[model samples]
Target chain A: MSRVPLTRKGFDAMRVSVIHTADDIVREHIVNKSVVMFDILRASSTISTALANGCQEVIPVVEVDEALAIASRLPEDTCILGGERSAVKLPGFHLGNSPLEYTPEVVAHKTVILTTTNGTKAIRRAAGEDGVVLIGSLLNYSAVAHKLFAAEQDILLACAGTRGKFSLEDTFAAGLVVAELVQLWYSRHNAAPEESCSPQADPVPIYAEEVPVLPENGLLLEDAAVAALRLAEAYRHKPLRALYDALHGQKLAQMGLSIDLNFCAQLNLYDVVPVYREGKITCL
Target chain B: MSRVPLTRKGFDAMRVSVIHTADDIVREHIVNKSVVMFDILRASSTISTALANGCQEVIPVVEVDEALAIASRLPEDTCILGGERSAVKLPGFHLGNSPLEYTPEVVAHKTVILTTTNGTKAIRRAAGEDGVVLIGSLLNYSAVAHKLFAAEQDILLACAGTRGKFSLEDTFAAGLVVAELVQLWYSRHNAAPEESCSPQADPVPIYAEEVPVLPENGLLLEDAAVAALRLAEAYRHKPLRALYDALHGQKLAQMGLSIDLNFCAQLNLYDVVPVYREGKITCL
Candidate 1:
């Protein structure tokens, strides 16, 4: 059975464990087994867009050879090689992992066998965990949270910061997620005195204690929750799910990768929650 | 002779070090022989303020006994004991370390004996070394740079972050010092193009190769410069000079013992450089 319908406030009550390095992700049991990937940089955002545009599947590999080997196995028309070393594009590839490059015209209905410096390394390392594995970015945050709330497992929103170093954009986005999840959990778990002991205590208090609390009813409230909800509803479940739109989403949109962002931001997009199965990511 | 006049561009270039824990700092270089103290929270900021005010002298002690012991040595009407445990002012402390708390009216013309958890410990550790130590913070960044430039000796702007853990604020302040010193060094060194061995042998290229170039003049300009400069400056300085500012100045200011930002900010106001002399801090 599903654990419980975790309200928005319920999520806020929990503290996020900050996974600093690629090694930290491996060492931390909780992170290895239960976290979702959130890379706000051009990589994850672009990958989400590529998937949503009807790509066959995103097979994340670590090394260049690994990506090529996987691509060699797939039908030539069905798969394409892509990624970057630094800010520059790879020497000889069908694409670079820029969301701006993965537009509806370019990547719509193409399978991207990809690897990245950091994000893919994280994905490869977290391949076979026991819990849900979801993609998170600014584009699909609301949809991801709503789905996460419905599932109600302990969540670890892993921010794929640059090369194991802290990046402001990633942390800021994670803070937004923690803030939203708490609010949603609170909405569902806030119980009257009669319902207090019924396994539905308010999650707001828990978040207040563990996480850094922003101003009450402040920008954190509107950005993490309200704006996210609006974006998800507008996409109508097309962006967050499906390999095609997942590769292109809203973060890309504002970054001039709008086509990708539009596709990556879909709400309630996929019924099957992806999980790490047998050293590989698989959907339920 | 003093090294050289510092350029305006010097202080603008900044970098910071993220000392994650007490263990990390200790492991890097912490022994009884090592004269280094820690400043985790607002002690750096407070001390900057105290020196800015008209405080006659500031005394730093490690233990509570040391603080009281030092106070006993001072004239009763001239001295005050101050500091804090957490954010709260200590039981007998005449003041709490907060930038907002220190004002000229209360602190003017007073002598203060101060102690704190992290900053004091770090200061006490670095109490005796060959180098002169001066407090560094946002409040006195320009002044520290000017003093260090004139002294021509190695400058170590140690940050007392929280309980040995890295605090963003302290790290940021450290970066400011690094930026200033590096720029000053660059401007002075770069001005001597006529002294080159050959017309084609510009030393600028060699210098650039030796020192890491900062990021482009963009949004991350401030952050990028701060961390880079801190590391470079620390490495460039002679390693022997050990000095502690905790006994007075910033530490004193934090305890509400006394000083002002203006006083701390005054560049090279003191011709007498305070170096680590004997087992305690003294002006050379």
Candidate 2:
């Protein structure tokens, strides 16, 4: 495929793709673009909330033992251990997989050594990627979207599905992000050209003609991204209600983790954009 | 997990799960429930259409060589070998992965030995299940839903995701099926209790109070199932538009297979329910 020059006028040609599970990550192909990873049930939301609460940084390890090993190497007073297995806190761990637990009082000024069943694995998969990797969820929705828009690169919304299978909450979070990005692109592209005198202005209104036309050889949405956008649109009117009624939400409720569901469902609750770089996630 | 007793009075407790990819199939667990396999961007649609057009039976083989070997063993004129690799037909195959090619004149009265990139692999994964296996798509949506409702057992909507990754089209198709089932269940469960004087009647109307109550410990929808239903609801207004704009659909169109997209996008075009039993998919 010939590389199309990125011109300021054609935001519609920017591609947005979604990877539904951590297991589906294609390292070679994915390394070429920026990625936003979502584990909305708790991991990503917790990380966002932790950073928003003034946590120094979060070290994500794939195994509980690895988190313990890393925590042992750090000063005990400056670091805190956090993670969960099967949605329950691991024995001897300081925290479980709940965003409510990562409050300002608990995580402030501390480096959180985190490991979870799915989120860390997804982060690890993108560890070798040359592009930027960011942790995202409903709590930090606009922050991540703004960062992604500024990056000016193709976006991949990677969903950290539960235990190698598709998770509704995570996929929904991805859809939410993708939908926001599409909307942002459209709003910018559809604005009256003379209003802002911006370089990214197209004098020709793309949809004004009798038969509206797509750009010639435009950047098309990958099917998964399209589906995610549709999903985001579907649940736009009471996102919290949808989250409460999700299958995982019910399971979490059954396990007495209703607080986590409530915490994860709060949209745009945090203004921090959690950047995962150099094996650690810290607020941008 | 304790097995919930099936009762006519409570439909909310019925289990409707979705397997997003073939890789997520747990043979031991999935074998216990009836499965509806969907490969909306084209396999399932083609199979359903073929059966609806009076094809004798559709045999799905996972391997291209297996399909060829099976075809060689059958009498020359009665059997036809069909499949595709990268959206194109094999050198000597009778058909490619286009639903339009499987019309009444081409596939009627003949047995189709079929293989494809993803659909057959999904079918083979569920072949060992001691339960009903059916081919489904938008073309025969109502038929498959009626059959599933009549079965009165747990339903697993298995999406034939592209090459072990979630394909937007397949997931959307699964969502469509689950949404229809949920709607069917609600309509039946919400009818006036006193009007019917039947054994299925509930003495107290479940939704009569200010706050509607779901049956106690009734049927539960898995998270993926709930997501699918929501997705189905999202695209209910313009499903064909969704299909034409699907990632895979765009790719198919790029490959000069717009005819298949048009054919697959048609809803309720066929009345036949294609049943896959003992290795053959035959019309009911």
Candidate 3:
């Protein structure tokens, strides 16, 4: 298991690149041989919830047409077409992109064919990575950290920005992931072990350079970092994770899509991790 | 002056349609429209400092050769050639893009013929606005606010992004300007200022509307108003305005560039506010 420390401030610093499109990410080589999607917004967040609740699989498509095509093969009542366009729910879609939309009653035993303008594109760009492809959001932030801690490669929190741009909410989500990775790395090596078991297993020092964590807190320490941290810390209590709701999320919620905040804000709800593999996103 | 309540978070909500080149800004009818040039790495910050520090005037040219030619026409030892090519100081130029290069000793009473890859192009695009043409940065944040508050028309904060894509630093700077404007609006008019203020009076309120603010803060804020508020609230303390020792300023401090933090931070120092007029920037 390897540990990476990504401070909130550090993450803020590296977020200097506002990735507009998946093409932009690829152009910049943002994948860096490792990639993970950070869509704090409802798409990725909802996918995490759906998978955790009971969905068999998530098919990420770039366009609404593709999502519909995928849905055509599944039983209409057994599968849901979910995603957004211009921040609004697609026409005739069974579900909109909101974590709250994936209630156990709504998503249980279903296959979710999802497509979004940004989230799916980001996932697609990160698909060729040589390492684990875990879904990250505030809901399962810690779970992703545990997975990364146990993995053996570099990490990239590819933010599924709203329409190919940078979203503070997603960056904030990435920062949270970075923070946990750092803490986990430190705990595994630096902190005094409870048992102090074997002499053969030496407690290694947790140097930031070793784990190669993205500095989530980088911007927080900068001129802009202080402000961003204040925003995140201010919402330390609420389902402010709700603040990250995609444009689609709000529209659907207004239409009585889903009322439960628990789905959106539940921390560490699922222990199972979803990994991106061979063009499909699935849980192992 | 009108007090608008702007924050970083609020500014993120609006859609930021970025015009990639100065030509695009012009061809797309964005030139002279409300725009902000976001040069987060250095040039914009440096220029802000240079203007504030009592330099006669900044001749913003695009081509490096043009900048050099303009400098040659100025009085010998009275003009300095400064700018960057690829984030590095141009070969044979007096200075680089680092803020530390511009200083009082170098730039005092001298004109700087400056050209950079992105910032200069952004300036050209913002060549015709009915509102004030003010430079923004961590260096002269308050100065920019004072200028905008006193202006008669709407305000645009353009980010001179790296190349044609979004740069995190520039968008963050735009977030600061938007946040400040929104904050002032909130303080003066309360919640319904949108009902009272003209688009020209406080254009910041209309950030929710699709009207592109020109050089977009696409990556910085998803919701313009909310993102702006969040950014301002994040940096509510620890005045970074005093740290305006910028690229040209640092060089002047040594010999060529002439500027200081006090000058850059001098709120509303330029009684004569510049604005875009007739395809070029001129005094209002």
Candidate 4:
């Protein structure tokens, strides 16, 4: 059941909605929609990282036992266990939920089975029988949007917030995805980006009206999307700085994992757009 | 059922959380917390308007029959049965949910027993076992913030979004409340409004960093609160225009209720802060 039933009935418009946390998944219907899942503080970033580094595939599961079970079925040398509970590596797991741990030297050609406190659960929950689910992060935001641009489907920015509460970094990353999508649309229509629209430009009031849509390509921003986009506009120029300033960023910094923030914050570091379908994530 | 379990353990910190919709209330605990509920498009606005119009207590209920049953027990002349379902005045009810309908001429000296689609459920849900509940709207945002500022409690902005989805106007109004609270904090310490800080000024980046904290007056903004504040900053100068441009605003205009938008969008029109306690709402 769609929370906003009638408004979504007619248009095949790219009506984007941002679900603030994994717990909010129950309030939304994922059927026939395209979901871009973000856990930018790590999970989605890690998937983007691992996939770009030539990991064969990533299997995200909600439970540690499930990840272990999936891994046990694969050849030991061909598969790796990765993820975290309480932001620490699970006992007997091969790696924690950090993008830095998934470098090419480490995960090349290996299937990574992952479980985490929020991200994996978020990815699993955001999936549906008749929808497309793509992993997104600041690292591959434009790539993710490129894959979704021509699809006439509802888009849900599935944010894997920290423990069911809203995560600033995840939503911030989702906003980046939303902005990238809008910028792509503008470019497709032969509209040049305003001087103030550059990611490196100083912050300015980038009005939503800048998104002038053609009738056939109607893109609508739901309330959450509009809010996310505004918040994203504020920190687009200094995304890494913005991410480092998030509460989780501060905590991770304190945890001696400051390396991960720099890893996750690099824009378009990976052009690989990972798609999660049939319980596995793989990318070109 | 606190969504952020461990972090809230030690705070009397006035940590403000913005629940984007009424459905999100389930993930938060209201006990020992003060909630400022906003259904700014009309319900809470109607409450603020009615009370400001010199009405007696406003009784909010979720069901039509309960409103009717309560009104039946009161002196017929002393209670006004007012509410709406699906944005239309309920048959047999004396008034609809529009703030314009609760003029001083109609609601004066009468207890309004209200039953609305989302607003009552939000107000009741935000109330806790041992905390304060206040109805909030753009019409009385500052008054509500003033009441909460010195309370030294965790404050939740319980936004009654449409159905189980997010509402732009409600959160926008909630943002106004958040900004007002911050501005109040600034003013308390004799910090004059920055050149760009006035609500009537052009849109500018009102940095969250502007809110410096003293040891005793520490106010922390949660993720949703931060997002809300950014949204508020974008529209503080033209809130009425912003409200009128919201999806619900256009819907109301289409429904011939455009006049209500002007009424609800008026910031701090009523200095009266209505408190919801023990099943009734009243103000001095």
Candidate 1 has a DockQ of 0.04
Candidate 3 per-residue lDDT, tens place, A118-191, comes to 77777777564433356777778788767654553345566666655446566566545555554564465565
List model 2 lDDT by residue over B157-212, tens digit each: 88887766667667677777776666576667784322212111121222122221
User: Tens digits of per-residue lDDT for model 2 on A52-156?
Assistant: 999999998998889989999999999989999889899999998788888889899999999988888888775554434788899887778877776666777
Top candidate, metric TM-score:
4
Model 4 chain A is weakest, by summed lDDT over 10 consecutive residues, at: A199-208
Hey, what RMSD does candidate 3 come out at?
Answer: 10.2
Query: Over the stretch A1-284, how does candidate 1's per-residue lDDT look in tens digits?
Result: 12122333423233333333334455343432236676656555666666555554567777898888787887888777889775446776788877657666766667677777777777655433443356666655556666665654455556565555544344434444554565575566462222211111112221122222232231122111221222222222222221111212212332343343333333324333333333333332
- Please give the TM-score that candidate 2 achieves against the real structure: 0.81
**Candidate lDDT (C-alpha), each:** 0.45, 0.71, 0.51, 0.75
Sort all candidates by lDDT, best to worst: 4, 2, 3, 1
Query: Candidate 4 docking category?
Result: incorrect
Task: List ranges where model 2 is wrong by over 4 Å.
Answer: A1-13, A62-77, A85-97, A128-132, A191-219, B1-13, B23-26, B62-77, B89-97, B103-106, B129-132, B191-218
TM-score of chain B of 4: 0.85
Reference-based lDDT, residue B25, model 2 = 77
